[model samples]
Target: MTVNPLATPLSLPARPELTGGRPLGVLLLHGFSGSPASMKPWAHALAERGYAVEVPLLPGHGTRWQDLNKVAWTDWYAEADGALDRLRASTEAVVVGALSMGGSVALRLAEERGSDVAGLVLVNPFVSSTRTELKALPVLKRVVPSLKGVVNDIKKPGQDEVGYPRLPLRGLAAVLEMWQSVVPDLPKVTQPLLYFRSSVDHVIDPSSSPTVLGAVSSRDVEERILADSFHVATLDNDAPRIFEESAEFVARVTAS
Candidate 1:
């Protein structure tokens, strides 16, 4: 349960060099079983561009996976949603940036908050799983608390995700439920979208991109393929592109 320094939350205020026309804030969310460490660098990049940024350490994460096993997906969403609310208080508009399971939380926020959410930047996002075994998770989790983790799927050497070493089954089942809820409201996500997908990702499957691109009602949607990266594209070889382009997206969307 020893906390890694990178796992801590990050909060930065808007600076004089702000990118957009108005005060804009961004809330970045990390994936399941993962810590804020995965998104810290990305948060700093946005903060440097003069955007208010918040990277919350989602509940039941950044600690032992056993704690993750005790919480549901709702807990994660609550943390993300609260962060968005807090950011909105000081900014004219907000953008949600997410990786993996964090994407689900972002989509739900957009679906519910509508115009308040200025845009979205998703990297290797996941909303559903084709893995057949998940159907039994509701029952299986009663017996098993966790499995080995699926973290640090980066092609870049020396990259570390700092995620929990185990996969929490209770949380996994709850996230699947969140996916179910988000998918149905995809049409409500009308904000501009910047979607980044890793062509060689090992954690995310092929279905997520199509599901989001096909269902979202957003008129401004851009899909970028990370051909050289894996699941954790934020820390992968193409990470600079993700950071740079996302800042650009934030600027374009927040500009009035």
Candidate 2:
């Protein structure tokens, strides 16, 4: 019996497209406080397109709350970077795809990888924000911990209600640290970039799109808008198009 690596205990409702053959190796990064489960479909699509997709569970993710509290930005980046490095070791060209905060890590990887990185596909990349709440008290971040395992009524996916109930303060601090580290280096990101923005994202500020558009030096940058989805567009109604466009972007960049 040939062991199918994609077959996890998640018993992910089999999407035929996910199985078949592999083409290019793609590193798929999920959003902050998100699990690799969200990127599963997109991975399947990319795999069906003959691409090998790697969706890594970032450190401090997909597990308990205290585990997340212990890790920092470097841990997350190292996990993502390790996945990319593994993909690069086996493939000629690697395309980095990320959602939200994951996009930040992916962009940083592209900048560091330079010519070796083929392109970038970013979904709702959180750049700078004018949101008064986050700016007002950066100190509040240190005091708060994730409310994930608490609030017994919280929905933990596959529930009737869908939303991220807990906001981890320490995690946000690490994210801010990462943003500060990456902002100055944004202009050096010359890899082809495809940025997808959600018009209705409540978690992300509307200003983020322009920040990314102006910051990234990618000569072939393209921006597309998702009208029906909120922050987690990858799992929303507009997901299929996002997957298609992303795969197409990678194909174009690698070919050129």
For residues 82-186, could you state the per-residue lDDT of candidate 1 as single tens digits? 999899998888999999999999999999888879999999898877778888899989998888889899999999889988888988888888887899999
Question: Global CA lDDT of candidate 1, please?
Answer: 0.89
TM-score each candidate.
Answer: 0.96, 0.84
lDDT of 2 at 156: 27
Give Cα-based local distance difference scores for all models. Answer: 0.89, 0.71
lDDT, residue 188, candidate 2: 89
lDDT of 2 by residue, 1-256 (tens): 2212332212112222332322357788877766666678888887767676788777776654455567888888898888877777766677888888888888778878797678889988875678677763367756666544211121224321112347676776678788888888889899888988887776778776777779888899889998877777777778889999887887777763
Best TM-score goes to which candidate? Answer: 1
Error of 1 at 26 (Å): 1.0
- Model 1 per-residue lDDT at 37: 86
TM-score of 2: 0.84
